[model samples]
Target chain A: MENHERSIRLPDNGNKVKAMQQKLLGVAVIAIIFVAWFIAARIISKPLVLPDFVETMQQFFKGWVDSRTMSNLGITLKRVLTGSAYAVLVGTVIGLLMGYSTKVMMAVSPIVNSIRQIPIMAWVPLSIIWFGLGEGPTVFLIFMSAVFPLIINTVSGVTGIDPNYINAARSMGAGTVAIYRDVIIPGTLPSFLTGLRLAVGSGWMSVICAEFIATSKGFGFLMIEAQERMQTSKLYALMIMSAIVGFVIDQLIRLLEKRLTSWRFKNGKAVG
Target chain B: MARLSVDGVTKVFEEKGKEPHVVLENLRFDIEEGQFISLLGPSGCGKTTLLTMMGGFQAPTSGKILLDGVPVEGPSSERGYVFQNYALFPWMTVEKNVAYGMKFSSMSAKEKQEKLKRLIEIAHLQGHEKKYPIQLSGGMQQRAAVARALAGQPKVLLLDEPLGAVDFQMRELMQNELEHMVREAKITVVMVTHDVSESVFLSDRVIVLSSNKGRVVADVPIDLPRPRDRSSEEFDKYVFKLTNLVRRAFQERTDTTF
Candidate 1:
């Protein structure tokens, strides 16, 4: 090891270059997917079933994404954010209660588990009946989609804390409130973050489902309308837009996780 | 004067369908105002359990622990307990961790800062205050734990195997550093350990406990002078004596049980 020359091939100062290479790798994969899409579209030669990549991109840029599509996307985003936020808040609180108290777990677990076993998709008709069609049912479906994962994850996080933190906090003269505030919450953060990520994914999924049933506008509505009207290019464009939105939101979440949990990675990923 | 007294403390754990397990039976000791005492034993000898009881994190089933003639009801800043794992909050920086105990203290802002600074220096953690515990080495974390423990100006320091998690090479240095800090603070220290040399080296008195009922089999005092030489015959003699006593205790417990 000592015999090796310092300047020959270390690349020790090439971290930026390494990062650029990683970005290029992601771009390359996307480019390959696009190439495959173009080939399939060309081979099919039918504009109704599998629209050509060029026509879809053209429709996305000029024809399809006008004020109406933009407004629909905005509406979907709003419902996703509002409903998921409520789910996260409620789920975390309930989870903390159940996690901290065995009695709460005993009472809540059966009901929560039983409800969670039913497919989130199966809740759409019931939610419409219960809340009536419109934003109410849409938001309710999205909340249900997000809440279970949040509750389960938060419960695990709260219960999974190392007992030493509690003991140490108590010994440090911390009262009950201080212990929970300073120790329990921070100690359970990594778990909560994991749960939040799951909530976002499921919440987005619910938003799409609710849009299919309740709304006259939104990405899901556009997909159904384009299919009925035989506007395959617009349909493909909306599908692409949905994929992009979901991918962007998940990436945003990952970015948030990296920023907030930087300390965990400062070492070798030490977690609570 | 006795700073901490273990008054015939006994602890028993009862299971629903199983027999009661007596962890410690009639355990008694009086730790002086500035003495450094070590409860040395084998694994699961209830040494850590005894330390927990002294910390007031757990209550003894029968007997009581008193500090300055007052019965200890719960954990307080007056008694600093260092866990075996150090138990430093990984989320906080070293400075934040050392300042943690002081937050609950009744000290004024300036006083707390002064104490925090003093303890950081005592723990030899001057530059590493901004770094998180997870980023630190085991030995440094132990030092940070000591600084945090001393932050609230506790009259007594209770350590649960202070050097147990440290590297072999760093263990001796940490022991010496811990001893120096404890002496400078003039605080009575009660430590639990399963190491022979560790007990003999860092403690003023080593209390060896037998396993079966967690009884104190021997209380050996090493009257060796300060800066005691580890290579000296006197030090070796004390180590040998304690080691043999522990071995005999092990033998006796097994013999009695059989």
Candidate 2:
């Protein structure tokens, strides 16, 4: 009993120490990158070409207090969220149709595949023409980038569903709607969530690109304005902020994935 | 009237620009109420296909399956099927999985609660109600599956190599549990398996199928008492006889293929 207790107790303590070491290592890596940036900036001796890390960090902190920066950040957030929501809704429907019926898949796949082949940047001109400037073109570009991953992932998810689950549900007297609710939807959810994550990442990327070309606001606009004015420190600050936001968004989706599919992670491994 | 009857069922697979393949030919069997029947055969003998047809998952190319004199059309709650994989919904907890079919059952809330409680008890899953299927071991998953199928209180339960996925050590314990569960439920069961000893142990009648075209080669009855000793002379004799028959069927399949 004493040996067993020590064996169990040791791992818990070991895990805590391991986690602490990982966190410290992460902090050390960031510190090293900042130091490298500082040294590189001094050696380059050109503020326009490479801003000092300390000055850029100051700019980053100042931007947090600036209302214009915050408002622009909010706008970018709203555009990306709106575009992603629409993509998820529309893509899921099309995906379900494609997955359920061979006729629909055959009809839609060729067109979808062809369109998906075109880069998100290539769509900007068409989007601007179709929707005009400002939020319209920007949101459209985000949607275009995001929807393909969602659609493709949802289709694979549906197609890859175990037939046994469907059969089991059917044998349990589940009708069409019940089968969807209990079997198909839950069965396809992990893949769908994975698709959503990829979609959102791509959507975030295209939104900034769209803003750079088509919009007068957002982080893209702020960065462009800083660059044109040779505010190298501010430009670097905006880039860092954008990256942090993107990281946070991805983390939020992972949290949501965990929340929605708690059953999959109950034993620290994906079941089924 | 039989609880379930397969009347001259034949399954043929037709592919475009290819000769039709015969999976099972002129197969006929009747399962009486409360009798444990096993369709024993080698792999590729269409036993799984036969079981699937019996559960109304697919249609036979010719003839029909009658359940209580009514034609089996499609999957219904009246016939519960336990797949080899123990296909419990990964998203639902063991309790919810067991209680799933009860939603469509005519049993009242009180009756369902009682039935669910008893099933969990018999399946030996009392403490793990809230746990998901993936959290359970192979034996536990199989037990939960059995509970889920029995929850519907179906007229007959069909199994497709139910213990095939479980580890060798757990198989015996599961078999004993299965026997007890069946005894308690007193429901008719039709199981498909390749294990000769398993068929002899669990089945009232073992319908041996030839590997070539899945024809019934022998229909042997097990006269052993409940919880029979596996090492007993009588048990070994039955296992030995059935093993030989299955081996011969396997040889015939190989000879025909070459």
Candidate 3:
């Protein structure tokens, strides 16, 4: 009986050990990279060009405590949230419409394709011309940057749904609206979440660019001001901050995606 | 009383730049109320097409299908269909999938709950109500699909190879469960299947159809007693007879084409 229990428990114990070892290796690698970067920064000449790691860390901490810096961060975050919300709402509606009907999809395909081809930087010129140098243009640029990815992913997700699912719904006496609500929306959720993640990343890039180009406030403007003054330490600090924030946001989105697709992975075996 | 009637029903599929392909021709059958009828044939024999026509998912090219003397234009709640793929909604829990059909009905929440409870019990899914379709095994998913179809209390239940996706062991168990459900519900059933033993096991009568311009060639009544034994001499004899008929149907199609 003891041997039987040991046999049953061995695989689970082995798996747990393997998972912990992998996580430890990942952390060790990251720590090594950080130490190497610090050492290299110390040896580099001209602090203005490449500030020492200690100085950069000090500046980052100061920026965190600074009221003006905190307010600027808040402003940047607000613009990103608002613009992304609008893009998601509008893009999802259009995507659902296009996904359901071939005619609508065809009609909108060319326009979406052309829009996607143009860079978000290119939109800055047009946005400034249309809405002038203010928050409006900044928000508009962010919205434009995020919408195409959101739309495309939503449409692809909705269209990729299995025909059997829809047929099953129909046989169960579901009306068009019920089918859309109960089947189409839920079926496309994983893809929609993926699109939202892409949109968030794109929206962040656009908002920062817009703030640097046209706005008087926000982290992007602070970075530009630091660049003009040749405050390399402050600049490095801000860059690090942005990188950390983006990484955190992406990780959060990934966590959400994993939660949503848990059902897909629950079988514990890979399917072809 | 007949629950569904297929009178001279024929189906022809036409493409943009090709000759029309005839699927079914002059297919005539009547499903009496509460009767279990199986449409047994090989692939591409138009059994699925005929089943779809009965369910109102498709219309006959030349003839008509009637449900209680009224013509079927499109899908209606009166005839519930169970797909071979066990098309359970992946997003919804088993209970929610069962309740999906009743969303449009005027039944109160409590009444819907009561009905759903009964259905869960009937489908033998008493404990796994909160699990999604993807969480369950193949047999369980098919059971959930059956529960979802039966939720609306449809007059006629249409099954298109409903047990095809399961393994042999599970298939046997589901076949028995299905027969029990049919008898208990007393609802008219019309199933299309490629499995001869499955048809003989669950059906009151099995309608064998010929391929390539499909038409009913035989309507054999299954005189075997219920709760059928697959290994019994009688069951083997029937299986042999049906297999011969199916082989002959294919042979006849080939001979006519040449």
Best by DockQ: 2
Candidate 1, residues B1-258, lDDT tens digits: the string is 589999999999999999999889999889888899999887767888889988888899999999998988888888998998999988788999999988988889999888888888988888778888867767788889988888888889999988887778988888888888888888889999888988888888999998867888899998899877889999999999999988877776688778
Q: How many backbone clashes does candidate 2 have?
A: 0
Q: In model 3, what is chain B's TM-score?
A: 0.96
TM-score of each prediction: 0.93, 0.95, 0.93
Candidate 2 docking class = medium
Per-residue lDDT over B73-190 for candidate 3, one digit per residue giving the tens place of the 0 to 100 score: 8887788889888778777778888898676677899999999998899888988887777767677788788888888888899999999877888899889888877777788899
lDDT of each model, Cα atoms only?
A: 0.85, 0.90, 0.85
Over B94-210, each residue of candidate 2 has an lDDT whose tens digit, in order, gives 999999967788999999999999999999998889888877878888889988998998999999999998779889988988888888889999999998989999999999888
Q: Across residues A1-272, which tens digit of lDDT does each residue of candidate 3 receive?
A: 35754675688789889999999999899889778868887887678888887888899999989999899988888888889899999999999999989999999999889878998888888888898887888889889998988999999999999987887788777889989998899889889989999998988888888888987899899999999999999999998888887777888988888777665654433221
| Candidate 2 residue-wise lDDT, A1-77, digit = tens | 35754676688788889999999999899999999999999999899989988999999999998999999999998
Clashing pairs in 1: none
Q: Compared with the true structure, what per-residue lDDT tens digits does model 1 show for residues A139-220?
A: 8888898898889988998898888888888888898899889877877778888888889888887788778877776778
In Å, residue B54's CA in model 2 sits off its true spot by 0.6
How many angstroms is residue B81 displaced in model 2 relative to the true structure, after the best TM-score fit?
0.4
Docking class of 3: acceptable
List candidate 2 segments past 4 Å from native: A1-27, A266-272, B254-258
